[model samples]
Target chain A: MTKYVIRRLLQMIPVLIGATFLIFAMVFALPGDPTANKCGERPCPAEYVKKFEEEHNLNDPLPIQYAKYMGKLAKGDFGTSFREIPVKDELSERYVVTAKLATIAILFETVLGIFAGVLAGIRKGKFIDNLVLLSTLFVISIPIFVIGYVAQFLLGVKWRIFPVTVNANATGLDSWWQLLLPGLVLGSVSVAYVARLTRTNLVENLRADYVRTAKAKGLTTSRTIGLHALRNSLIPVVTFIGADFGALLGGAIVTEQIFNIQGVGGYIFSGIHNRDGVVVVGAVTVLILVYLLVNLLVDILYGVLDPRISHD
Target chain B: MSTISTRRGNRAEAAAAPSKYQPQDGLLLEVDDLFVEFHTDDGVAKAINGVSFDLRQGETLAILGESGSGKSVTAQAIMGILDMPPAKIPAGQVRYCGHDLLTMPEDERRKTRGPEISMIFQDALSSLNPVFPVGWQIAEMFRKHRGLNKSESLDRAVRLMERVQIPAAKERVKAYPHQFSGGMRQRIMIAMAIALDPAVLIADEPTTALDVTVQAQIMSLLEELQQEREMGLILITHDLGVVADVADKIAVMYAGRIVERADVYDIYARPGHPYTRGLLDSIPRLDQKGQTLSAIGGLPPNLTKIPAGCAFNPRCRMADHVCRTDLPPLREVEPGRESACHFAEEVLRG
Candidate 1:
């Protein structure tokens, strides 16, 4: 198992290198002068342009530039944003906000989705099953932004239950309350997706022969469904949850924009608008790392859930 | 929810049931007029119709039939393990001792499943949960139903494994279903079934998936255990050759009904039903090595559209106008022998 984990960790090196290189190339290969774009609407002086090019290694070839960036990254230097703010410091400040939002949303999504899904799947074709299926379908059909706005209007404007926009200065419980609204908005789509996934997975497992054996063993129907069937069903759900959680952690862009929350998503937007290669590339690299780590965690969880799956 | 609720309601009635009808002396289980149907998009398929049988302790009753003859369905009906929606038992009486299992409350029925009655399914690999260790799965019967604590149940699981003659059972307790061979897995299944020394043990095609040598071993083990516990064994199978030596009585099913039933030796010596005769003749005999084997004409009828009157009328050579118009009920041909055929006497004269 240790060897397997170590091997997987080694394999990530090439993936990380490729992801960083691709993001770098995408930023540099854009039309028009990126250096001028970085300087904003006003044209920069000849000396300022030269200074920027030299400092950022724009004067070097792509390979040398990549090597230089990798060297800097290895030494834990993420460079500065176009606004001259240290990327690392900026990321540290906003990371907590995004983490809190994603965590809350994912927690709600997982608990509600799995619970409803298991019910619908086990009782397939029954009234409660049909109701859950239809509700999930309705949730899935609507766009995220529209859902976000409707939530904001109903929960924030009319009901006055939550603030429409997040309070940046808030801390602890106040901060949690502020995060809840946008989190729900951000997490709603995932809940529907996961519900559908869990329903399909669990329905298949319920029909499996082992489930019949469990019932024949004199287990209560609930216990048979929960302990025997549900564990097997959760194998595929783990994959879905891991990938979705990683994506949420990457940041809910429209959700962040709608809530006016300052997070990594907003950082990426500003980075793209200002043609800040360092910030965009840096944000994407971190997201890729998270995605890989989540997948690895999911694989490990598979070993726990299924005895047939050996780590080696 | 509706399914479970209705089952629970039935369970309540089972608990309230007046202790009026006692089982015939020495009989452990009595299944009377059992009817099972499956409702599908196509139509309702009558799987088992009016199937009745009696099982006595320390005896093995082999239910012989081809595929789709309702042998397995009867077993499932008796065990109360058939899935609903697809399956529905309109009318049946599965009485264990004096208790009606069909009307018995869910909790009461559950109590009966592993202790009063237990079942061993055909395919062991598919039947055993893939994720749990074999011992854990076996111990689960004791844990949930018997109210044994974890370690105690686990110890019992190990003992059961040893009793079933699983090699290195102490070490193999942690092994999963996929790790064991087909026979070993079936042995594990048998161990679990007999764990509580159930009064009636139904093994639905237990040796169907095993090799010939392993089949004999499994049967011998089952016989040994049945004698030890004085357990009534209901062996459901398609193979007549396997049951001849082991079964005390044989019930031959055709379509959804029992066409013939007799003592093992008598049934072989003289089958009163044409369908039973056909089944016996079809077996490849050593003396007729070069002769082409006899096969029953046509397939079993489509369950949704079983032919009118006798289900075997289409296949029986002696099927007549009387056979075409009226279903032959199972009638006594001799003491301890019954056959469902209009011309049972003519067939018996052979």
Candidate 2:
């Protein structure tokens, strides 16, 4: 089992590197220039362009630029922005903003996702199951931007329950209440999917001959459900949680932009729109890293669910 | 002696009570006219139709039937484990030791189920939770029913493992169900069943899913346990060979009802019902020489479209027009047996 876990972890490195390299390649290919934008609409002198090119190493080929970026990344110096603010400073500042919201969003999503799943599975074939299924479908069908805008208008604009603009000072669980609706709206679709998957897997687990045997063993209804049914039903649910964590973090861009919360999504938003290559690539890399970590954790839990697979 | 509580112990007094609680001498259980029905979208399908049987101390009663013929349903009903709504006991009685099992409150019935009447299942691998240690699961039964503390229950669980002949009982007690082989898992199931020393043990197809060698091992273990406990055992299966080896009395079921019932010797020597005869002839026997085995002629009749009178009539070779139209009531044809056939004696003539 230890060997298997170590092997799996080792295998993920190349895959992640390949994926991040592709993202870097894609960003490199985008037709724009950060220096040109910084230099403004006035056509700068050839010498000024030459000076900027030499400093940023734009004089090198694409592969050279990539190699340079990788080297700097290895040394933990992400270079500087077009205006000369160190990229590390910008990323750390932006990282805190995202950390503030993503933490709450993930917490909300995980709890809600698991709850919805357990409820739907338990009340299977009933109105509650059908309602949860339909509601989740509705949540998933709506675009995240639409969910964000609508929630902003309804809860922030109309209800005045939360501020229209996300407060920078209010942090932790204190501000979480304000972020809750946006987080819920953005994270809810995944919740629905989790619930649906959980329900299906849960129903399957419930019907497994083991559950029947547990029931016949004179174990009380609740004890049988908690001990025998829940743990066995969790493999698929755990996989989804792990795989979707990155999505919830990286993909909540529209939501953060709308809410005006200066989080990771917002950082990526400005970076992509402004063509700030450092922040864009860094955030994407971090997102991918988080996703990889979650997947690793999920793989570890598979062993806990059924020891036979671990023994294998 | 006559001045004593003769009224309390008399068979006549018991017979006057509810059909379920009518206990005879040393009888551990009695089920009479039990009709279990399942209400699907279409209509009610009788799972166990008017089934009646008795279980005496230390004797194993085998109810033989193919899948869906209600052998397991009868056992579940006796165990009070059958879920209601889709399934229900429409009529009849399940009496355990002069108590009406069907009418007993659920909590009271629950007490009897774990502490006095236990069951073993067909699929040993599936019947156990893969996440937990096998012995811990058994210990749970001890904890719940007997109120044993941690160490005591642990010791009892180890003892149960030893009793079931699981080697390295103390160490193996912590090993999960998946660690054990199929036969060993079934042995674990048997250990759990006997943990509470239940007077009546219902083993549903206990050996069907196991290999022949393991099947024999489980059967011998059960026989030994039966002798030790003097418990009433209800062995549910379709295997004539298994019933021959373990059961004292055999209830041959076709569709839902018992078509034939007799002692083991009588059932094997002279099967009264045509269905029973067809089944006996199918088994490859040591006594019969140089003959290709006989096969039962037809499919198990679809329960939804069961022939009106006798459910087995469609598959019964000796069935006549009367057998197709008139339901044959169970009739005593000999001193110790009963068969549901119009011409049971004549049919046995061949």
Candidate 3:
């Protein structure tokens, strides 16, 4: 297992390099000059442009520029944004908020989704099953932005159940409460997917021959479904949830934007708007690393869930 | 045959106090006039139509049938494991030890399972829970039924594995089901079924998924286990070759009904029903190597719309006006033998 994990970690290096390079190339290819909008609305003075180009290596070819950025990145220097603020400092602050949001979102989906799914699966073709199917369909069909805004307006503004937007200055429990609404909004679609995936898998496993054997063993319905059937059913659901956690960590752009949560999504969004290649590339690179780690974790978990799948 | 009278006497006493009844005269299980129907989208498919059989302690009763002939369904009904909505027992009495299992409370019936009655299914790989270790699956019978602790149950599980002839039981106790070969997996399944020393062990086509050589090994293992425990074994199978040596009595099913039933040797030598004769004839013989093998023509009737008379009438060579107009009831054609056919005497004579 240790050797397998080491192999997996080594495999991530090339993927990380390839992903960062593609993002760097795309950001460099975007229209508009980074130096143009820096000095008020007018074009920068010739002297200022020369100084900026020389310092930032803007006159160098794209490949050379990328190479220089990568050289700094290898030493943990994320470089400075166009406004001269360190991208690392910006990312560290924003990533914490995004991490909290993703954690809460994941918890909401895993707990509620699996609960509802097991209920629906056990009582398949009944009223509760139909209700779950219809509601999850409803949640899946609507876009996240609509759900976010609508939830913000009603649950936050109208009902006063939660605060309208997350307090940027708040800390500890107060900040968690503020993030809860956005978290729910962010997790709404995934909850639907998780519930559906769980329901389908659970229903199928309940009919499996092993389940019948469990019943024939004189196991009570609860023990049969809860232990024997549910253990196998949750394998695929866990993989989906783990991969979804990685995707969530990448940040929900529209959800973050609607709630004004200072997360990775908003950080990357503004970086693209300002065409600040350093911030964009830095944030995306960290997100890519997180995704790879989560995927690796999921694969490891797969071996644990199913003994037939050996890491060796 | 005298045990039947003793069983009836016990039944009368059992009716006076049902819960106090116990198996007397070696009557381990009695499935009486059981009828099973499956409610499908098309219609209700009559899977088992008034099927009845009995198992005695230390005796093996082989239920012989083709696929979809309700052999497995009969076993499921006895185990009380049939999925109720799709598969319902409209009318039946499954008496285990003179107590009516059909009328027993679910909790009480559940208690009887594993310790009183247990089943092993076809496709041992699928039957055993894939995620759990083979020993753990066997150990579960003890854990759930006997209230044994994890370590104690696991200790017993190892003993069972060794008893089933699994090599290196201690080392492979934690190995999963897929790690074992086909025959080994089936042995694990049998070990699980007999874990609590169940009085009645229903094997639903247990050797169907195994190779020929492995099939023989599994059968012998089952026979040895039955002899050791004096357990009533219900061997559900399609292979005539497998049943001849192992089964004490044979019940030949066609279209969800027992078409013929007799002592193993009697049925094989002189089949009293046309369907049974067809099945016996279809078995390949080395003596007639150059001759074309005879086969039962046509398919088993669709359960939703069985033939008006006898279910096997469409495929029977002797099917005539009387055969098409009236369903032949399973009746005694000879002492200790029953055949469901209007021309039973003629078939027997032939």
Question: What do the candidate models score in CA lDDT, each in turn?
Answer: 0.87, 0.80, 0.90
Error of 1 at A159 (Å): 1.6
Chain A TM-score, prediction 3 = 0.97
Better of 1 and 3 by lDDT: 3
Candidate 2 lDDT, B1-350, residue by residue in tens: 22211223322211122222223576878899999988888777878889999898778899997788889999989887776768988899988878888999877787776566889999999989888888789889878767778787888889889999998989999899988999999999999988877678999999999999989999999999887766789999989997688889999998889988899999888888988888888988887878888998879876666778888888777788998899999888888889999989986675
TM-score for every candidate vs. truth?
0.94, 0.92, 0.96
Question: What docking grade applies to model 1?
Answer: medium
Model 2 global lDDT (CA atoms, 0 to 1): 0.80
Which regions of candidate 1 are displaced past 4 Å?
Answer: A37-42, B1-24
Candidate 1 vs 2: which has more DockQ? 1
* Model 3 global lDDT (CA atoms, 0 to 1): 0.90
| Among all candidates shown, the one with the greatest lDDT | 3
Q: Report lDDT (Cα) of residue A249, candidate 1.
A: 84
CA lDDT, candidate 3, residue B187: 92
Isolated chain B TM-score per model: 0.92, 0.91, 0.93
Task: Compute DockQ for each candidate against the true complex.
Answer: 0.71, 0.56, 0.85
Worst 10-residue lDDT window, candidate 3 chain A = A28-37
Give the per-residue Cα lDDT of candidate 1 at B136. 97
